[model samples]
Target: MTSMNHNQRRGRVVIGVDTHKHIHVAVALDDFGGVLGKEKFTADTAGYGQLIDWSMTHGHLLTFAIEGTGSYGAGLTAAVRRRDIGVVEVMRTDRRDRRLRGKSDFLDAENAARAVLAGHADAVPKTADGLVEMIRTIKVAKDVAVKARTSAMISLKAVLVNAPAPLREQLQPLSKMALIHRCAGLRPGSMTTVEAATKHTLRSIARRWEQLNDEITAHEKMLAELTTTLAPQLCAAFGVGADTAAEMLIVAGDNPERVRSEPAWARLCGVAPIPASSGMTTRHRLNRGGHRQANAALYRTVIVRMQHHEPTKSYVARRTAEGKTKAEIIRCLKRLLAREIWSLMRPLRINPQTVESAA
Candidate 1:
């Protein structure tokens, strides 16, 4: 009897893709994890179509394991999903595994398929085609502008410290904002002396700071408007402002359903308690692995509530009386806040206006 080919025996296929800026390498494996075909395609519309068609010929397209779904693979993921094909985000192969198996584009592509077949790569890639993406873009711009402004201020201060006596004496006592304003208004006309040159440099830096401040303000305003429109209830939640709300929204992505459950969300925020049990030392420890920005947002919310919300203040007092350290109390509070935020975020994925209408 003739031996059946692997594709014929398995019938179903999985495609693994290693994406890059200009090209994507793909490998197709049968249900039994046998490589059927491997190909390289350009990272564009035509290439995506060819890749899909190429994989389909091996057998039925089961799912796609793609690296960098949020970065280089984003467009391809969207394209595949639009055609109703399943896609999962695959992180880079472990260094140890790479070292053992040896490395090549085909090897990485095959690894991605093996990961999917073995259930190692099961994360649903984010559908970054929504208002949250817009918020992320604006936030990134604002963050860069703020950093530049801060650097400019630091350099301006450094110059001021070494400035000529006449200029230093004039500006040394001014507060930060006042100093920027004063330097921006300096009328240093000629580079006749060291003091004049110093004044000119300070003025330029101050003007740049002013421009960045305006840019940040504009971005904040856009964030406020978008957050209010997307999830008014989240924005209105006690102690949650536009910046904090926006950060959390970005973490949850446009389709929060992929987050799975509240516990998962808590883990994503790094507020979940991790089991640290050993032989007879059963306990939990604070998790330190999730999105740090989301953790900071939760921390800020807890602080605001502790200061102004009566029930939270009473809870704090009770915890303190129960011998909990301040840090421990904050950790507990962060976990609780993460659960509450998760509850609020779930409805957002389905209908962002649900909370607003209820209110």
Candidate 2:
């Protein structure tokens, strides 16, 4: 009996972690669904070590089911991954369950462990330590800069609208680029009059727009180079440019295998049709879930294809002739694009094992 009990103690264990900004709560459970221990640790390198040591005391560590692997739990996830342990990203527990069972950090952690044991949460989080991550970071800056540049342009135009008659007439006659150039060259000597104040505002805004434009151009060039290097085939594919390709890559993360299949890819991009069938009314509607940015990317690609690509044009024509509405046709085309993208990207996936070893 003692030997059997000892063997039971040696069985594999699962650790669930509810992560936060300053601390992480963990629960250890044996393979047989028995809770072995609960602990809390600081959200840092030293704390991660302590958590791992405490979990190991229960039994052999099998996997960690963690909440917010992309956010709060990211550090701990990376640490566990560095040791080559499996990690599963646990989604938020069902609100209904939480309402019934009540809520606490410890309970949340336990639920995460049980979720893995029950085979509910199986998502592999993105390994945000690669070229894709670099692309994402740069793209973030580029997108914000683009928005700021647009705002500056708008503000420049708005100021011109209310400027003194001579100034308004002078600037309004120019094209957008010409107006920007003229405004940027304006020399406001003093704030003595309305004209000078108007000139000052226009010049400042135009210069800001120019700076942001330069920054955006630089970011786009870097993105083009990195995305092309990472997935030459994807970049070379129809209807995909640097921005769109970056969006798709960000959606897939550095680990493309996490997507599993083409259908999964479509679902991730929110292009997969969702069934809204009821009894005799069998039909699928456009899915409204998944990554919105990816969905927009797919939409942009399809629009480009609809206008330019010969094969896609022909397909659209055929579908249109068959009584399919433009929306339905576009939906189908997005799914097809997702499939093609998945195939093009699969071969380019960097091996996680190779990445781990290099780390």
Candidate 3:
């Protein structure tokens, strides 16, 4: 089975990897997207070695594109890169779009491989041993914490809704520090003992929410450390704190060279607008393409910039006077911020202000 999979006659091979948590499937395709060989294996050392060996025996593994490199895709990409194997991280096919045709792991893997071979898929490979993956993991943690915090808030609000006005007043400050204290005794006076017992269950939920707050803070500190160490250069600027810098740097991936243009970064963040034209009209709107997570991080930075500092305030006011709406102005500012970010992250040339001075 391994030999059949390892056949050198697989033609010029472009590999597509369908990534999941426990297992990964890789298919080698010829130039015409014909499947030369396909194998399903666990995403462990033995599995990685088998896949690499298969590719090396065939033509050089020209490009390996995997979907969602930041999630389940991380382990596979890291494994491949460790073997000096080149990887192309493809975006996942939209489930709705995929369903329009059909849905299966086989189809997903084929679409990914075909995307790479057809020149339709271009993924920015991470550099410095996939540090972007590590930073991206922190983002996952941050998001989890956010959800936990939100759940806690929702529970608090539920309590407020059910409690009498007096009880609400007691808990209102908790809206501010509500998640800080334990919710062991929270109960509505109107409820019977049974109802009270169930209501108190919400207190347990609130306690869990408090734990999430601590976790969120801890993950944020770890994210800060990533910037402080791997990308201290990114954090050197005003308004670009550890979280902002780390998010930017992570999506930038250590391989800044893979992103050839500032517009590429902007597009990846979905902050750059697309030009839509009719027979006689030409207008640009917010880019509907690229990674939404990266776009969101940049959007948050824009909000932070507008509210936090002088230059950002002046820029917003100036753009507003020039007749741009709030949405239009934000889009413009995000692009500008993208350019500044690209300059600071000049992959080929290190600015003295970045890693050097910090070092």
Candidate 4:
């Protein structure tokens, strides 16, 4: 009687969530992988609270294993962490499992719980509630603006290539900046002729390019200020520009301590070497996983250093003299750069517990 009651009271529970735009499906599982219950919640403040209260009814809320913590699950993750419960990011169910059993939101939610119970889902989702998140948002805007500006420039050039003979010959002689300025100043009053229509199109594209360029500049300025404030040592490193620094910071997230070590940081950037050796031929290959954007940033930094930074230039020369291919040398440089950036940023890691308690 009393013993049975105490055993019931000691039950441990895990909750898994499959989140969507408007709703989230959740499943509660006991420690031994028994299905406790399932529930659906609205993807809002009220719904998140209800889900938490419901899970507590099953037993002690050990953890929430959630998919899409960086996307749809972001809100619930923040809310859960605010209550000091652990959140483990679980990847979507394996395709083979789905093929075997078919699929539903409930199944996914169940798989998430199972992943946590089986010791497979161990990743701590990014906090996404601090300075790094601000940098990430600004970086996204800057990337879009730069991409739009480039597209506008391409369209303007394509128009030039197909413009009337006289117009093409006239603009072909001008430098890119001069051509854009001249086109932006053109006035195609009524657009009654092909040439006039072409003029209007060129003016429209040029103006769009100008506007996007200005927007990009503003975004870059903000990124520079924000990234510098977040990691001064990273920004001060040679060949580490505002854009590259922001990408690195975005990869590290608001909680750098979650990264574990310098090598883990390298692995996260996709610059780490993966073993691909045989018994008699030991070797490694480029890692194709992790954050490619951060990898690209690493490449960009290495390129700049190769050309301008004296020590890096010397290293390149020495490696080349030792018969390393450019690709191999570049990979080596990226790994080293990842290590350097990781150390510079490590000291800046925020203690999320302190932050949550303070809040």
Candidate 5:
């Protein structure tokens, strides 16, 4: 990979980055879309620094436009933010079809840079390796534990379905303890040929599941510690539980400043609908934009809150009486919830003198 240095102090240049797991391709363009340099670099610290040195040596690097900020772009974004470099996230290939033709590492990088110059693709990027990553790791581990517990219960019930009536009755109330003890004592050689084989496999699974639960509890403790040290604003909000708050913070990329407005946040979560107006019918349909996983987090949240939150529940009931379907009502709730979250969260942004204030 050739390292570039911007020896010429040209006007603002646009950088397009095509990212992969270990390598990233970047292309630089002068103010007029003239290709200045293109090269491959390792995604690590040394590589990005060389890219930076190249940019500065040639001229001022205006910004980086990259496709898909949530995945391969994540490492790159984290890398850039650590350097305080300006990077913009471009919508994926679906944003335009023409650019999709003749795609390659070099071409994709060029398109990313061109998109910056053309002003067609861009977003204020959030950090990749900040509190967001910490939150996500904790949440995933907890989810694994919860799933394991659920699976254990399900498997126990399945075993009961075929169990002898007297045995089932004896184990009914003592199910948890009985299952745990039996599973703990089970080994490959403990039973007859067939019985031992089945018991050994199932018991191994149970033991592994129990171990996973222990890991989950440890993660929970870590999560509790981080809740106070970081993401305090999210933790302080009503209806935002630990896992939910952690997910939302990660989705927002830890820096609420780039989230901008309620609509922006909603759109980022794929909850806000795109505007579609026909001659006679003008209504907003759901938008599948931005992060679907984050949108699902909000969806799960509102459902839990709708059962207990009087104001939000009443709002849904009122809208329901107006003949809105359950799905429609849920959609409306998602948007409103996005707005509320944005309002509660905007004050927590790390930036100062921010523009484009939204209600």
Candidate 6:
């Protein structure tokens, strides 16, 4: 039988990483929170291997505390976990701490390790290697297309407002779609005159809008298909559509098990009620923090249920009869929806260990 090495015999160690575009700063610490070593490595596969090997020299690497796990640190986090090491998502160092202790990449990396050791940062980073990632990418494209289309429409209208009287008269009375079709069909033979210039610009903007519409449609179709495939139960749930399901999935991340619980999921979506108690007054208020997009998805789900679901309508009516305000009712509905969505998403959960192994 092979004998255990010194580093291997050591109980456990933690590594903290401060990641950047081209480089990463790492700090290693023992179980008792003593610094082992610090090093800088290139932000690449080779560098990841070197960093892991170096950390293992100090002790058994039990976990990594990483900052910006969704952005700059994502690659490093993925790389480390691929070796079956645990990774915790660490928030950036508090500004107050930076002011008092000063700031440097090495210091930040050390702080990350200390935070994890102190039990201050315990959340697992998302595994962005699955269908949820694909949906997020598609949603981003769709968002840009929608924004561009709106801008094109606004510009088209603004130009018409100042266009030549004859051209304005010719286009102003048309409906929005009709105006776009007409402008796109315009034959601007000459750009030498102001009227011709107006026609040319309008035609360009209208055509761009049409193209964006097509792009958005394609993205939506793709999103619907992907969301359904990823979470059919979520997609089939009352008041949950492709867009809402996609947003929820993105917020929960590719590995839903990292969410911990339904309340944690609600907090992530900004639907968790925050306690606002005073000496003689005990009350909870709406949470304004968390992912706004996810909150909006929950709101949209509530709206759909309010409008069409019989049981939801009854609940609303009963709440109103008991003197609850519409906003309060909506808040309650959102919390309920959050719980429902979390339950549905749980079945699709991927074990965090599986994520690390598959990384």
RMSD of each: 3.2, 2.6, 5.1, 2.5, 5.5, 3.1
Output the lDDT of residue 318, model 1.
100
Point to the candidate with the largest lDDT: 6
Please provide, for model 2 over 1-359, each residue's C-alpha lDDT reduced to its tens digit, 9 standing for 90 to 100.
67446745677789999999999999999888899889899999999989987876676657899999989999999999987889999998999999999999999999999999999989999888887888899999999998999899888888888999999988898998999899999999978999999999999999999899999999999999988878888999988999999999899887878878788888889988889999989988888999999999989999999999999999999999999999989989989998899888876564532233334
Q: State residue 329's C-alpha deviation in candidate 1, in Å.
A: 1.3
Global lDDT of each candidate: 0.89, 0.89, 0.73, 0.89, 0.72, 0.89
Mark the regions of model 5 whose C-alpha exceeds 4 Å error after superposition: 1-9, 68-84, 95-100, 144-182, 185-191, 228-233, 236-238, 350-359
- TM-scores, all models, native as reference: 0.93, 0.92, 0.77, 0.94, 0.80, 0.93
Model 6, position 271, has a per-residue lDDT of 90
Please say which candidate is ahead in lDDT: 2 or 5: 2
Can you tell me which runs of candidate 1 are displaced by over 4 Å?
A: 1-10, 352-359
CA displacement after TM-score superposition, residue 310 of candidate 3 (Å):
2.6
Across 1-359, the per-residue lDDT of candidate 6 in tens digits comes to: 33347677777788999999999999998989888899999989899899888877787757899999999988888888899989999999999999999999999999999999999999988889887888899999999999999999999999999999999999999999999999999988867899999999999999999999999999999999988877888999998888999999889888888888888888999999999999999999889999999999889889999999999999999999999999999999999999998888877774322323433
TM-score winner: 4
Give, for candidate 4, the lowest lDDT window spanning 10 residues: 350-359
Candidate 1 on 25-108: residue-level lDDT in tens? 999988888888899999999999989888777766468999999998998999899879999899899999999999998999
Candidate with better TM-score, 4 vs 6: 4
With candidate 6 superimposed using the best TM-score fit, by how many Å does residue 41's alpha carbon deviate from the native?
0.9
lDDT of 2: 0.89
What is the alpha-carbon lDDT of model 4 when measured against the actual structure? Answer: 0.89
Report how far off residue 210 is in candidate 6 (Å): 0.7
Q: lDDT tens digits, residues 163-201, model 3?
A: 656555665666456433535456536667654654576
For residue 346, model 6's alpha carbon misses the true position, in angstroms, by 2.9
Clashing pairs in 2: none
Model 4, runs deviating above 4 Å: 1-8, 350-359
